[model samples]
Target: MAENTRKGTNTTILINGQRGAAYIKVHKRRHIGYLGASRMMASSTSPVDDSTPSPSADASLGLTKPTTHLRIKHAPFKLMHPTYLEDDHTTAQGTQWHSRASRKHLYTVKLAKVHLDKPSTDAEKATTSEFKIRGELRLRTCHPHSLLKPRLAWDISFWVAVWFVCGSAAWIINGFLLFIPLLYESSSQGVQAAAWGFVGGTFFEVGAFLMFIESLNSGHEELYKKALRSILNEDGGTRKQERGKLRLFGLAPFRDIGFLGSTIQLCSASIFWISTLTGLPGVIPGFPGTSSVAITDVFYWTPQVIGGTGFTIASVLFSLECQKAWWKPNPSSLGWHVGFWNLLGSVGFTLCGAFGYGSVGNSWMNYQSILSTFWGSWAFMIGSLCQLWESIWREANT
Candidate 1:
């Protein structure tokens, strides 16, 4: 859309491609998710009183400019991951929704200023023209430039997968030990099972904590953005205020599905610690005692229920983050697969928590709960393995 500003003329680009041309993955318009060109309405908090004016349309779309041929904006879009924005003078002067996906699959969406390619026909001295730009969409590693890089073994994803795998494996064994009555009847085996559960729960808490921390700087793109700005020094606004507030704790009530999911998951893991740790034979005085069902319920069962519920919510949010439609699976999306299994595990854990409550002496309830735990742990392990595999081979087939 064309509009006049107090200082100069500025064009408000909408995502629908009504005013300009937009391309996904540099040419592939048929994306699997809601990855779209990003546009931001002018905000009162803009660092400067004046917004960056849209460049005047020349006889050509600045193809003659020294900066190189094309004047179009390139935005990388990842259909499999949550959307984020990276604003730099290299593209434009405003924020836009973008994707910075895998190394090989660095799918970038380009929004070109086709209108500015020609001089206005009825001009009294017109600086801007009007035209609809069009381009084919296709995925290619040789082109579609992006700043995103491949994952490393020491990255947050790797650690998260490692911890989850260990934790899930431990829980699987613990569940099995309790599920079999003969094994559980032996006091030594029961004690050992509790010990294993404690270890598993500890590992879960650590992994969940890491995930929440990772979300603080989701995708770790901010660091790269800052690094690039140090060299380019574009826009002249290097102050912290102009860059935006520190998102160390994930600001706002409810933004970013991954952030909310990780936060909830972390809290759940922490709360569940109460049951796993205290239930150890010597951790607490009244814990692991057959004498009082009420005490066991208070310390163990209650926390499990609360944690399980939280985990379920988190898992759902995570799954939702990976989907365009909540009911349908994203074809060929590894992130979606990871979410699917985690959601299944969350459901199992929820059932386990529900059945494990009330009477500690109910054999039926115990068996059902243990069975749920065993299945849930297996599901969790599978998801963890998938994540690990994805993290390790991010650029393999991208």
Candidate 2:
């Protein structure tokens, strides 16, 4: 029994010894594995330091030593094996740092408010204000070149002179025609013929002159030049449309001056012609020819002549108003002043007074004759003279 017991104890001791050896081996191997893993992790976490100086620093400040304390973190997985992982991480980090540094260098911190340090002076303020006022005036007024051009001035002067001269001539001719007939043996017949001629001639002359003036004042060339300039000057800038409305429309004061003048001329011519045509006997009671003509005819002819003179006076006054427009300092207003007045005079004298008078008296003696023969002629003559002075002024200025 003792021997068997001893043998069991020996076997137990051997088994325990074998178990101890195995545990020691496992512990040592585990420690060695942990040590290897730690070395790999430490190397992976460490950063590479560059020995080159930063290019962004000023070279004039002197050369700077490369920084050595700088470190970069690297991945452990890359260190475990030879691979392209380290290269990619290095390139990406380098690019990111370079971009960040560039951004920092681009911005400069300005320490002073430079613009606030300067204040405007009184002279500068005055100059700026004056400039603004001048600019506004330029925008509102007509173009300088357009107004000052010699052609426009010449046209205005020519038309005005023509109207004045023609109107005066018509008045003088009508008077002559009416009076010459009264000096002959067949006074009645001679007067009648002269009267008809006077009225007819006035109408034809005035109409022709007016038509000519209208043709000359077409404004086609001026408009074409303006349009051409606009097209050539366009260069992606904002453009404003130009206006083509007549200047007289805006200038109300000068509106009726020409009309008044023309009316005077028309009335004066009509009266002289009608009186001559009717061949009313002289005031002598025993005078030769028929007294059958109505008393209305006697009174009518006299008033017609008187009324025409009144209209002529009014025309003279209105022409003075037109002259005012021409004298304005603004050159742009000059053309308009001349154009509208000329138009008014032309239409009122020729078309309304002269042509219109011919259609009156029913080819013998009509109501229109009484209205036009005296008043129209007188008005035209006086108005024309007034315009004559205005033209003279314009010419002198030129």
Candidate 3:
């Protein structure tokens, strides 16, 4: 019929006319680690006619059958107990009740049927059912939704990026190092490098394509557009504003920095692969002649310049992403540090290409060019390995 609760304790009184009896409910907060206090309700029948039972007497009675009429009160001295006042409260009525007072912790409110010594009537059973339903609703309100997990497509894209880097290494080692030197001696040697470059470039392209897809799937594109719209005031007010340039060269502006970098890198791979095809022996026929030499010099060195430039920009972007904390830095940002090596490789390749074209017969110039290109490839390989480590670390931490 009535309820009274102190700051730390709650008491519920139930009055029943069937047997002219009463019931009391006492709920105390307890600290039991992650497992919230049990939801089982203790029912007890009064052994003596008292407004509130004595501590020693209540302890002696333990838990008894709950009756219809009751008067519940807090034990003032129990405040000294460790679990006595830790922000917990419980209340129940026809169809509404709540427990666990503190916002700091989440506790599920559940109702367990309190078995009575005698068979319960329809009215009592209905009351019990209402308690269960209300308790379940309260639990749902406590924990609304589950946390989002990383998607499988994102993971797949990451692995593809890894493979793309590996392919680049294979292409450099097999195609350029092993095959390119023997180009004038035998056209067949060029085939090995061409095949490997194709394989490597294909993987790189696939990875880059997947990155684009993942960016869309992750909702970064829409976020970028929303940000653009806000900054540009695209909704148009009383003042007319210039239209924001959200697209570049008729394509969506790449708001995903990593994806943009990867796309550029893919373009670099394509140019370099195309260079491999053009420099093959059969492409020009008269191997060491002036015209053939001129063609070879132009075709072979030109793509390196373009590719190196793209790669340099991409490496810088990747490094910036690390600085921005977009990609979790691997223990003091190993990936960021590793990217410097790739940047160095880009410089090497760029220099190699710049000086390579006109000085084909100049032994010293040719030597410097080959040496620089070699350094670039190895540096890029090392950077790729560092990236791989970063990806592995990210997966493990997640």
Candidate 4:
């Protein structure tokens, strides 16, 4: 048996591996039980180091306190990451921590109390307070109605008047002239009648095309002014965001889709009208059924084909735009009807051109070519009138 010993608040037990039995005693109490040799340790106390700092030392440096929560009411700068600043006691400084998911929001930390060896001036404190103020600008969304103005309405009215008066009168004259060739007995009289019809058509088409150009320019100018106002007056203006540029045949740029489509259709029509001039004065002076000099070897039907194709493409694009406009909430009263009429006119023109092509191929389709052309031209003129009326209605109501 070993002699018993006592230590400070600790007791030791020894186990015999052969018997697998042990007895432990503490402060007048004893435990006798079987024990496992592997579970017993010879030295059980953990070593204490004298170099460890006490709780008082940690508290003195303000390290024991929990992190304070800060509510940033409004902030201007969008924080990207957690920003750290060295603790300075002279002036109030904040640290901003941003969440990865949200770029606009941030958590800012303002230390409650700081120690400073030197005193701060009034000017320095004022500057520090100014830095604490935060704000952000919320921009108003753009709408089509926002672009409309009184002056713009007046401009649209003036142009619409010009288009209707000239375009309508030209259509009336051409309608009467188209039937004259059938009534006339002389072939020369028919030629003269066709020449006069072209003259009237050219006069009105030019007027209508000019008005369309003016309206487009007016729209672009108004929108540009609106864009400028947005930048100078609104705080949320993003300088980098800009409108799309429109280009036609590598010339000056525009932005309005309606304007672009109309311009293309009119330019193609101008080309179509110009082609009619080639057939004029067929037997110039002395030459019989031939030109004095061979001006162009291209077939008589080539220009019509090319010009008609251009007109068809422009009409299709414009019709699509009209369909889109039709679906818009609270569109103009005449909007959908205008689109329908224009689409019908375009279809007629396409059919007319196709029939003309068939006639050139010496097909029996030539029998109906004049009738198709006459009706198609009339439909186009009617659609142009509807466009003018729609503009007038808008000007009066809007």
The whole-model lDDT of each prediction reads: 0.52, 0.29, 0.42, 0.36
The TM-score leader among the candidates is 1
Off by over 4 Å in 2: 1-157, 181-242, 245-310, 319-398
Give each model's clash number. 7, 30, 10, 0
Model 1 per-residue lDDT at 106: 31
lDDT of 2 by residue, 147-245 (tens): 222222344334645555565565456544443443352333434434444454455345434423322322212211111123112231212323333
Ranking by TM-score: 1, 3, 4, 2
For model 1, the superposed segments whose C-alpha errors exceed 4 Å read 1-152, 181-188, 219-253, 284-289, 396-398
lDDT of 1 by residue, 110-178 (tens): 322221123323221122213223222112112223344464657665787789889999988887777
Per lDDT, the best of the predicted structures is 1
Give candidate 3's TM-score: 0.47
What lDDT tens digits, residue by residue, belong to model 4 across residues 1-398? 22223355433333222211122222222221112211222233222122344442223221222222222221111221111112232223432211110111111111121111122433223222211211110111111232322232444334644554555455445544544454463243435544654564465456546545543432222211211222221322112223322222232223334455556766766766654555355623322133333332232334455555666666544444433222342134233344445455445544544565555435355435545545655665666665555444321122
Decide which is better by lDDT, 3 or 4: 3
Model 3: per-residue lDDT, tens digit, 104-168? 01222322112211324332232222222100001101212222233332454356448657765
TM-scores of all candidate predictions against the true structure: 0.60, 0.29, 0.47, 0.44
Full-model lDDT, candidate 4:
0.36
